[model samples]
Target: MTLSLTAQDKNTLRTAAYGAVSLIAAADATGSPHKIATHGSIALASATGPVGHVLAEKSKIAGLDGKTVAELADHVLPALTAAMNLLREQDPAQAETFRSTVGIALDAGVGARKGEPGPALTEMRRKISTALDAA
Candidate 1:
């Protein structure tokens, strides 16, 4: 299916996808944040379909520079909902792909840890999942 997304829409998608990785990475207080980010980003980059193409773009995802995790969430969570809503409007299947892509990225980040994720990591994951499901 041909998907139509504006530049702003693309920005929202990129921000939501990449921002999710950043969120999970930030949640890893003790573990290797960089490693989590790397794995999560790779998962996002590996996404398929139109969602993959949009996320694979190198364009800047602004508003992800918040110093605090809360600040970052303020910017990202809404984008997640927005991106999902936009895609589902055009194509539900593509929306599912986008959701799966983001979920996998989160898993990659969380899985980077040696053992079970810490409380913060788990909570942050819950928040991200809640945001994704909000749409």
Candidate 2:
């Protein structure tokens, strides 16, 4: 099936994908936040398929400049769900691709830390996965 995403839909997907990496970076305030973000973003860039295409577009994604973690989550978590919902409705396969792409990006981002993730980082990862599954 052909998936027809509007500009807003594409923006939502971009926001959700990029916002997740930002969330991980934010959650690692005490650690190497820049490393985490770079690794996660690189993984996101490596994604394939429709999800990858949407992420690759360098258009105006929304709500990524939040000053606080909580403020960022307010826009991102819902965007994660919304992106998933839109994909699932139009193409379940793409939805799975989207979910997996985000999950892989999260893993790559979190793996930038050499040792076990701290409690806050662990919880933020869980929340990201939960939001992806919420759709």
Provide the TM-score for each candidate, comma-separated.
0.97, 0.96
Every candidate's lDDT? 0.91, 0.90
Tens digit of per-residue lDDT, candidate 1, span 18-85: 99999989988688889899999999999877999999999878998999999999999999999999
Single out the weakest 10-residue window by summed lDDT for candidate 1: 108-117
- Poorest 10 consecutive residues of model 2 by lDDT? 53-62
Q: Per-residue lDDT of 1-135 in model 2, one digit per residue for the tens?
A: 878999999999989988999999899999988988899889988887778888888887768999999999999999999999999999999999988888888889888977888999989989999999999
Model 2 scores a TM of: 0.96
> Using TM-score as the measure, which candidate wins?
1
Quick one: RMSD of model 2?
Answer: 0.9
Candidate 1 to truth, TM: 0.97
- Residue pairs with backbone overlap in model 1: none
lDDT score for candidate 1 against the true structure: 0.91
